[model samples]
Target: MSGRKAQAARNDELILQAARAVFTADPGAPIAAVAERAGVGISALYRRYPSKEALLQKLCGDGLKLYIEVTERALAEEGDPWEAFAGYLRGIVDADTNSLTIKLAGTFQPTEELGHYAMRASALATEIHRRTVEAGVLRPDLTTADIALLLEQIASIRVGDERRISELRHRHLALMMDALRLPPARRELPGPAVTDEELSSRWWTGS
Candidate 1:
C-alpha cells in the first residue's frame, strides 16, 4: 500500500479504537469526543464516518463480530459442560463491560443489515445454549432470550464509583451461574421468561 493510504488506514483504526472507548462510557458521546481521543480533528473523523449514528453503527457491527468470535471460542473450549457454560457467561459479561457497543446492543433497532447480524449472533448464542442445556447444566426452562435479558441486567449494575465494572459484572455472573444450575426437576420460576416475540419487538429505530 502507498504510504499515504497506509497512514489513512492507521488513522481510521485509531478513530475506531477511540470510538469504542468513548462510546462505552457514553453511547451518546459526541463525535468530537471520538476525534479528541483519536488525536485527530473532527473534520478527519467526519471525512470517514460522516455522522455520529453512522460511526456508532460501524462500531456496533465490529462489536458484534468480536462477540461472535469470543462466544465461539468459549463454546469450543475444552472443559466440563457446566464449566463451559459458566465460562461463556463470564466471557460475555467481561466483553459486555468493555465493548460499549455490545453494552448498548439492546438499544439498537435491527435495521436490514444489522438485523441479519443480530440473527447470526443470536444463532451462535443459541448453539451455545443448546450445548449447555444438553449437558443438563442449565435450567431447562431457560430460553436463549433469557440470556440477553439476564446479561443486560448484569451489565446495568454499578457496584461502586471506584469499583471495576467488569469485576462487579463477573461477581453477578458467578451468582447467576449458581442460580442457573438445573434442579432435580424444573422448579417453578417466578414469572414467564422473555419471549422471542418480545425480543423482536425491541428493534431500535434511531428515535
Candidate 2:
C-alpha cells in the first residue's frame, strides 16, 4: 500500500476502535462522538463508513465473528463439562473482550459472512450442550434455545452502577449456572423460565 493509503488504514482502525467502545456503552451514540473520541474530523469517518449503520455493521460483524471463534476454541479445550460450560459462559459475559457481542446481539441480523459464522457458532453450541448433557452438568430437559436465552438474560441484568458491572454479572451467572444443573443439585428457579415468545419480542431485536 502507498504511504497515504497505509495512513488512512491506520486512521480507520483508530476510528473503529473508538466507535466500538462508544457504541458498546451506548448503542445510540452519534458519529460525531466517535470522531471526537478518535481525534478525527467527522468527515473523515463518513468518507470511510458513509453512515452510522455502516460503522455499526463493521463493529457488530467483527464482534460476532470473534464470538464464534472464542466459543469454538473454548469447546476444544480439555476440561470437565462443568468447567468447559462455566468458562464459555464467563467468556461470552466478558464484556472487556467482546463488548459488542452481547450489546449487538439484539440488533444483529445475519448477513452473508456473518450468517455463515452464526451457523458454525450455533453448531458448536449444540455440541457443547450435548457434551454438557452427556456429562450431566446441565439438566437433560434444557434445550439449546434455553441456553441462548439464559446468556441473553445474563446480558440484560441492569447494574445500578457501572463500577459494579463485572461483580454483578459474575454473581448472576454463577447463580444461573447452578440452576441449570439437574436436581437435587439444581435449586428451584424463582418464577417461570423465559418463554420463546418473550425472547423473540425482546431480544430478537434491539431493545
Per-residue CA lDDT of model 1 for 1-207, tens digit only, reads 899999889999999989887877787788899999999888889999998878877877776777787788888887888777777777777666334534565654545777677688888899989988888878889998888878878877543332455555666666676788875433343323445654464474447
TM-score between candidate 2 and the true structure:
0.73
For model 2, how does the per-residue alpha-carbon lDDT over 1-207 read when each residue is reduced to its tens digit? 999999899999999899987887788778899999999899889999898877877877776667677678778878777788778888888744345556765664446876776688788889888988898767899898887777777776544445455656677777788878754355444434344664465444454
Shift in Å, residue 52, candidate 1: 1.4
What clash count does candidate 1 reach? 2
Point to the candidate with the largest TM-score. 1
Point out where model 1 deviates above 4 Å. Answer: 1-6, 97-111, 159-163, 183-207
TM values, all candidates: 0.74, 0.73
Q: Local error of candidate 1 at 107, Å?
A: 6.5
Clashing pairs in 2: none
Error of 2 at 172 (Å): 0.7
